[model samples]
Target: MTARTARQRLRDDAGSAVVEFPLVAVLIILIALTLIQCALVVHTRNTLTDAAVQAAHTASLEGNEPEDGATRGAQLVHDRFGEDYAVEVDADEKGEGVVRVRITATFPLIGLIGPSGTLHVDGHAIDEETW
Candidate 1:
């Protein structure tokens, strides 16, 4: 029964950090990557919502057609982010003066590959005065 002394303890722990460093570093990297993926999904969804809203506004104009709104929404999604996110853009008249825009797109799981139609957003607006 005796103390190992500072020098012996230091030697024993010398290679321990080398082994632990990789394990710790890998875990940290994994966490960081997961966080980035989540952020990407959120950003894609939010951007889709924005595109839908823009389309709704454009389509709800006094004399704009629903098709025009759909086109505008698709273009906005492509221009703002990229073509990958804009899978489908649909616009229709909800009523006499209301326009609805729906956007369906795929968000990035990693490097632009994800489940299709996973992210969907809808927007509505009132048409302007036509009289």
Candidate 2:
């Protein structure tokens, strides 16, 4: 075979970049989407924690009613994630001034596939005078 000319080699290399560009672009887009999903998860967790803290504070202000505190916390969670989600609340030992709230969400990851993720928020609104 005859040796290739500079012009011929240049022409051959032109479309190589175009072919590789789309594959790389697709990979980059996927990575960015995954990162965004992770951020969303973190944000959801933070929201749950805030709701729990508010509920604990409210319950303590009213009385040492753990059930009331839990109901309030769960209501906040339901407001955000909807009533379909799971919520559980419990109070710590007397003096700890803390309450636990767990929120579970069931969502689809892709077509016909999905998994459940739980967000647990522990809020300690103990009175300064107590524990």
Candidate 3:
């Protein structure tokens, strides 16, 4: 091929970048959004788990009732995440000197809104009286 033809061929590929750039950019943006959503879900799960554990420990203490633990867990969730998340917490003895706290809430599918009663986590602690 002549140099002139080669130059024209190179120029033809120029606008191709403009079209490809948007496609690549859109893909990158989608990947970033997915990562962000995953992080949000993980953070939410961790927070709920921690709150449940704290509540369990509190209720396992001497002279504490399971209802008190449930109330405390709900309060912790409300304090951290506000009323946006409808969280239900329950505490009960598991028949082995263990107190278990269960937290059930919505799974954050999109921006902290999803199906209700989908996510469940449990926390267990030894009862102080059993020690």
Q: What is the TM-score of each candidate against the true structure?
A: 0.80, 0.74, 0.87
- Pairs that collide in candidate 2 are none
Q: Candidate 3: where are CA atoms >4 Å away?
A: 1-11, 113-117
Highest-scoring model, lDDT: 3
How many backbone clashes does every candidate have? 0, 0, 0
lDDT of 1 by residue, 3-108 (tens): 6676678677668888999999999999998998888778888888988999999998887898999999999988988664447888888657788999988766
Clashes of 2: 0
Model 1 spans with C-alpha error above 4 angstroms: 1-11, 84-86, 114-117
Q: Can you write out model 3's per-residue Cα lDDT over 7-36, one digit (the tens) per residue? A: 989877667988999999999999998998
- Candidate 3 lDDT (Cα, 0 to 1): 0.88
